[model samples]
Target chain A: MSRVSTLLARETALAWGKGGGPMVAVGFYAGVATLLPLAVGSEPERLAAIAPGAAWVALALAALLSLDRLFERDYEDGSLDLLTLSPVPLEIICAIKCLAQWLATGLPLALAAPVAAIALGASPQLSGLVVACALLGGLAFSFMGGIGAALSLGARRGGLLTAVIVLPLFVPPVIFGGGALASLEAGLPWSAGFALLGAYAAAAVALGPLAMAAACRNALS
Target chain B: MIPEVSIQSLALSRGGRQLFSRLILKLSPGEAIALIGRNGAGKTSLLRAIAGLINPDEGEIAFGGVEPAEAREAIHLLGHLDGLKSSRTARDELAFWTGFGGGAPAAVEAAAARLELIPLLDLEVRRLSAGQRRRLALARLLAAPRPLWLLDEPLSPLDAEWRGRFGEIMGEHLATGGMILAAVHDPLPLATRTVEVGR
Candidate 1:
C-alpha cells in the first residue's frame, strides 16, 4: 500500500479504536443536544427556534473534545520525533492527521447531526441542509482545531488552552453555518452563508497545515 | 558502501544553560561510539541533534553522500522512549514503523525473529515487559537497517541474556558496515570509541 494509505488506515484504526473514538464525540454532541431541551423545558417552539444553532454549537464542542490528543500523544511517545524525520514533510503530516481527525470524528458527527436536529424539533425538511452544513462546518472545525492542537503540544493545560485558541477561530464557521440554516428556515436564499462557509473551510484546508507544521516543529525543537 | 557522519564544532544548550559546546566527532562505517556522561550532560541532546530532531546551537553535522534534507532517513534513532502505542500489538507496531521507513513486510519478520520477538508478536504492547519492549524497539534497527544508529540507554531493562543478545546484534550490525552512537553511563565492550560529555 502507499504510505499515505497506510497512514490513513492507521489513523482510522486509532480513531475508531475502543478508546471511545467517534463514539465519545458523537455521544457528547448528543448529550449536549438532549440536555439543552430539558434544561430550557420542552417548549417545542423555543426548541425549534434554537435547535439549529444549538446543534452547531454542540458539534463544535464535540470536535474540541478530541482535538487535544491529536498530536500530543504522538509527541509524548516520541513518535513525533520519528515522524518529523520521516521522508514526508511536516506539513503533509499535519494535513494527514487533520484528515484522519475529520474522517473519524467530523464525519460521524455530521452523519448524526440530523438526528439531533430532528430530536430538538428542527424542521425535518431542513434535515438535508443540516447534514450538509454539518459536513462543511465539521471540516472547518477539524482543520482549525488542528492549529490549536499543534500549538498546545507541550503546554500545560493543553486541552483547555486549545479550546481557548480555537473557539475564536470557530466563530466564522459557526456564524456561516448557523446563518445558512437560519436563512433556509426563513424561506430566504441561503447560498451566501453556504458559500462563505465553503470558502472558510477551503481556506482552512489550505492553510491550517502550515500553522500546524510550524507549531509541531517549534514544540519538537 | 557506508556513510560517514562528521560533526564540526557542534554545540547545544537547554533552558539557557549551555550543555556542551565546540564538540567534534566523526564516525565511519563499522564503528560504534559510546557517549558517556552524567544525567544532565546532554547525551540525548547530542543524539537528537544528530538525528535532526533538534537544531544545534552551533556547528554542522554532515552525512556524506546524502543531501542535508534527506540525511535523517539514513539515521535510526532509538530514544529512551520506545515510541510504541500501548494499544497496538507488537506485530502491528513493527509493521507500521518498518513500512513507514520504506522497508518490506519481510523485514518485519526478519527483525522479529532476530530479536526473538516471534512469541510476543500478537500481544499488545501494553502487555509486554520493559525488556520485551526494548527488544521490540531495537527490532526497528534490523527492519529498516539505517546506516547510523543513535541509541539512548539501549541496555536498560534488559536482563543479562538479552543484553548479550543485543550486543551480538550490534556486533553484527557493525560487521555489515553500520555505525552506532549510544548514550550510556556504563560501558559497552562493543563500542569502538567513547565520547564523554559535561566535563
Candidate 2:
C-alpha cells in the first residue's frame, strides 16, 4: 500500500480503536439532546423553536471531544518524532490525522445531529438540511479543532486549553450553519448562510494543517 | 547509501542555561560515537539538533550534501520514548513505522524474528515487559535501513542477554557501513569513540 493509504488505514483503526471512537461523541451528542428537552420542559413549541440551533451547537461541542488527543497522543508516545522523519511532510500528516478524526468521530455526530434535532421536535422536513449543515460544520470542526489540539501540545491543562482556543474558532461555523437552518425554518433565503459555511469549511481544510504542523514543530523543538 | 555527518562549532542552551558551545564532531560511514555527559548536559539535544529537530544557537549540522531536514529519512532515532501505543498490539506498532518509513512490509516478520518478538507480536504493547518493548522498538532498525542511528540509552532496559544481542545488531549495522551516535551513561557493548558534551 502507498504511504498515505497506510497512514489513513492506521488512523482509521486508531480513531475507532482508541477511546470509544464515535460512540463517546455521539453518546455525548445524544446525552445533551436528551437533556435539553427535560431542562427546557417538554413544551413542543419551545422545543421545536430551539431544537435545530441546540443540536447544531451540540455537534460543534462534540467535535471537541477528541480534539485534545489528536496529535497529543502521538507527541507523547514519540510517534510524532518518527512521523516527522517520514517522506510525508508534517502538514500532510496533520491533514490525514484530521481526516481520520472526521471519519471516525465527526461523521457519526453529523448523522446523529439531525436525529437529535428531530427528536427535540424539529420538523422532519428539516432533517435533510440539518444533516447537510452538520456534515459541513463537522468538517470545519475537525480541521479547526486540530489547530487547537496541536497548539496545546505539551501544555498544562491541555484539554481545557484546546476547548478554549477552539471554541472561538467554532463560532463562525456554528453561526453560519445555524443561521442557514434558522433561515430555512423562517422561509427566508438560507443559501447565503450555507454558502458561508461551505466556504468556511473549505478554508479550514486548506489552512488548518499548516497551523497544526507549525505548532507541532514548535512543541517538538 | 552512507552519509557523512559534519558538525561545526555547534552551541545550544536550554531554559536560558548554556549547555554547550563551540562543539565540533565529524563522522563517516561505519563510525560510531557515544555522547557522554551529566543529566543536565545536552547529549540528547545534540542528537536532536543533528536530527534537525533543533536550531543550534550557533553553527551547522550537515548530512553531506542533503538538507538536514531531508536527511531525516536516512536516519533512525530511538529516543527514551519507544513510540509504541500501549493499546495497540506489538505487530500493529511495528507495521505503522514500517509503512510510514517506506520499508517493505514483507520485512516486518523478519524484524520481529530478529528481535525475538515473535511470541509477543499479537499482544498489546501494554502487556509487554519493558525490555521486550525496547526490543520491539529496536526491531524498526531491521525493518528499515537507515544509515544513521541516534539512540538514547538504547540498551538500558535490557538484561545482559538482550544487550549482547543488541550489541551484535549494532555490530552488524556498522559492518554494513551505517553510523551510530548513541547517548549513554553506560558503556556500549560495541567499541566506539566518545564525545563529551556540556563540559
Candidate 3:
C-alpha cells in the first residue's frame, strides 16, 4: 500500500476502534431528537413542525461529539510526532485524518440524521434531502472541526477549546442545511440552500487541512 | 554520501527561559553522540530542533545535502512516549509504521524478531508493560532505516539484558554508517562521545 493509504487506513481504524466509534454520536443524535418532542409538548403537528430544524441542530451537535479526539489522541500518544517524519506532507496527513473522522463518525451521523428527522415526525419524503444535506454538512463539520482539533492540541481543557473554536465555524453549514430542509417542508425553493451547503463543504474540505497542518506543527514545536 | 548531521550555533528557549545557545556539533556517518546534561538542560529540545520539529533560535542544522524541511525523513527520534497506540496490537502498530515510513511489511516481522518482540506482537499495546512498549518502539528503527536516531532516555525502562541487546543493535546500525544522537543520563549501552547541554 502507498503511504497515504496506509496512514488513512490506520487513522480510520483508530477513529473507529477508539472511543466507541459512531455509536456515541448516533446515540447523542437520538437523545436530542427524543427530547425535542417532550420539550415541545409531544404533539404530532408540533413535533413535525419542529422536526427538521430540531433534527438538523441535533445532527450538528452529534457531529461535534467526535471532533475533539480527531487529532488529540494522536497528539497525546506521540503518533503526531512520528507522523511528522512520514514521507507524506503534514497537510495531506491532516486531510486524511479528517476524512477518516468523517468515515468513522460523520458518515454514521449522516445516515442517522434522516432517520431521526423522520422519527421526530418529519415528512417521510424529506428523508432523501435530509440525508443529502446531512452528508455534505457532515463533511464540512469534519473538515472544519479538524481545524479546531489541531488548534487545541496541547492545551488545558482542549476538548472545550475545540468545541468553542469549532461551533461558530459550524453555524454556516447548519444554516444552509437546515434552511434547505425547512424550505422543502414549507413548499418553498430549497435547491439554493443545498447548493450553498455543498459549496461550504467543498471549500472546507479544500482549505481546512492547511490550517490544521499549521496548528499541528505549531503544537509539536 | 557520508550523511553527516551538522549543527552550528544552535540555540533555543521555552517560555521565557533560554535552554541552551551557541551549541555546535557534528555527527559523521557511523558516529554516536550522547547528549548528557542536568534536567531542564534542553536535551530533548535540541533533539527536536535537529529533527526539524522545532526551529533553532539561532543556528543551522544541515542533514548532509537533504533539504532542511525534509530532513525529518532521514531522522528518527525515539522519545519518552513509545508512540504505539494503546488500542492497537503491537503487530498492527509495527505494520502501520513500517508501511507508513516507506518500508515493506516484511520488515515489521523482521524487526519484531530482532527485538525478540514476536511473542508480544499479537498483544494490544495497552496490555504490554512499558519495557515491552519500548522494545516495540525500537522495532521501528530496525524496520524503517532512518540514518540519524535522536533517542531520549532510550534505555531508562529496559533491563540490563535488553539494554545490552539494544547496544548490539546500535553497533549494527552504526556499522551500516548510521548516526545516533541520544539524550540520556544512564550510560548508553554502546560507546558514545558525550555532548553536554545547559552548561
Candidate 4:
C-alpha cells in the first residue's frame, strides 16, 4: 500500500478500535438525541418541528467531542514529531487525519441521525434529506474543527479551548444544514441551502488542512 | 554515504530566557555526540533544533550532502515520548510505521528481533513496560535506516542487559556510516565525543 493509504488505514483503525473517539462521539450524540424528547414534551408536532434542529445541534456537539484528540494524542506521544520528519508534507498528513475523523466520527453520526430524527417525530419522507445533509455537514465540521483542534495543541486546557474555538466555526454548517432540512420539510425548494452547505464543506476540505498544518508546526516549535 | 552535519552559531531561547547561544558543532558520518547538561539546560532543545523539529533563533544547520528540504528524511528523532499508540498491538504499530516510512518489512522484523521485541509484538503497546516501550521506539531507528539519529535520554528506562544490547546496536549503526546525537546524563559506550549544552 502507498504511504497515504497506510496513514489512512492506521488512523481508521485507531478511530474504530475499542475506546476510540468515534464511539464516544456517537454515544454522546445518542445521549443528546435521547434527551431532547425529555426536555421538551413529546408532542408529535413539537417534536417533529424541532427534530432537524436538535439533530444538527447534537451532531455539531458530538463532532466537537473528538476534535481535541485529533493532533493532541500524536503531539503528546512524539508521533507528530516523526510525522513532521517524514517525506510527506504536514498538510497532507493533516488532511488524512481530518478525513479519517470524518469517516470514523462523521460518517457514523450521519448514518445514525435519521434514526434520531425519526424518533424525535420527524416526517419519515425527510429521512433521506436528513442523512444527506448530516453527511455533508459532518464533513464541514470535521475539517473546520480540525483547525481548532490543531490550534489548541499544548494549551493548558486544550480540550475546552478547542470547543471554544470550534463552536463558532460550526455556525455556518449548522445554519446551512438546518436551513436545508427546514426548507425540505416546508415543501420549498431546498437545493440552494443544500448547495451552499456543500460549498462550505468543499471549502473546508480544501483549506482546513493548511491551517492545521501551520498549527502543528507552531505547536512543535 | 551519510552527510556531515554542521551547526554554526545556532541559538535557541524559550519563555524569554536564552538557553544557549553561539553553539557550534560538527559531526561526520559514523561519529556520535552525546549532549550533556543539567536540568533546564536545553539539552532536549538543542537536539530538537538539530532535528529540524524546532528552528534555531540564530545561525544555520547545513547538511553537507543533502538538500534542506530532504534533511528530515535522513534524521531520526527519538524524544522522551515513545510515539507508540497504546491501543495498537506492537506488530500493527510497527507495520504502520514500516509502511509509512517506506522501509522494507523485512527490516522492521529484523529491528524487532534485535530489540527483543518479538515476544511483545502481538501485545498491545500499553501493556508493555516503560523499558519495553523505549526499546520498541528505538526499533524505529532500525526499521527505517536514517543517517542521523537524534536520541534523547535513551538509556534512563532500560535495564542493564537492554542497555548493553543498545550499545551494540549503536556500534553496528555507527559502523554503517550512521551518526547519532543523543541527550544523556549517563555515558554511552559508543559516544565518541561529548558536547555540553547550556554550560
Instruction: Give the alpha carbon lDDT tens digit for every residue of B59-139 in model 2.
Output: 888888987667888999999999989999999989888888878988899999999899999999999999999999999
DockQ of each two-chain model: 0.76, 0.77, 0.82, 0.86
Candidate 2 C-alpha lDDT tens digits along A1-221: 88898999899889987799999999999999999988999999999999889998889888999999999989999989888878888999999999999999988888888889989998888889998999899999999999999999999999999999999999999999999999999889999999999999999999999999999999999
CA deviation > 4 Å runs, candidate 3? none
TM-score of 3: 0.98
Predicted candidate 4 versus true structure: per-residue lDDT over A1-221, tens digit per residue: 88999999998877666366677888899999999989999889999999988999999998888788889999999899988988999999999998998999899999899988898888888899899999999999999999999999999999999999999999999999999999999999999989999999999999999999999999999
| lDDT by residue (tens digit), candidate 3, B1-199 | 3379888898899877899989999999889899999998999999888877888779888877889667777878898887889999999999998888878888999999999999988999999988889999999999988888899999998999999989999999999998999999988766568889997
In model 4, the runs with Cα more than 4 Å from the true position are A18-20
Model 4: lDDT of residue A204: 97
State the lDDT at A185 in candidate 3: 93
Residue runs of model 1 more than 4 Å from their true location after superposition: none
Between candidates 2 and 3, name the one with more favorable lDDT: 2
User: What is candidate 4's CA lDDT for residue A59?
Assistant: 92
Model 4 RMSD, rounded to 1 decimal: 1.3
Give the C-alpha miss distance for residue A105 in model 3, angstroms: 1.3
The lDDT of model 4 is 0.90
Better of 2 and 4 by DockQ: 4
RMSD of each: 1.2, 0.9, 1.1, 1.3
For residues B1-199, what per-residue lDDT tens digits would candidate 1 score against the true structure? 3379999998899889999999999999999999998899999999988888789999998888677678887878899888899999999999999988888989999999999999999999999999999999999999987888999999988998888888999999899899999999777759999999865
Q: Candidate 1's residue-wise lDDT over A59-139, tens digit each?
A: 899989999999998999988998888888889888888888889999999999999999998998989989999899988
TM-score of 2: 0.98
TM-score of chain A considered alone, across all candidate predictions: 0.98, 0.98, 0.98, 0.97
Q: Candidate 1 recovers what fraction of true contacts? A: 0.63
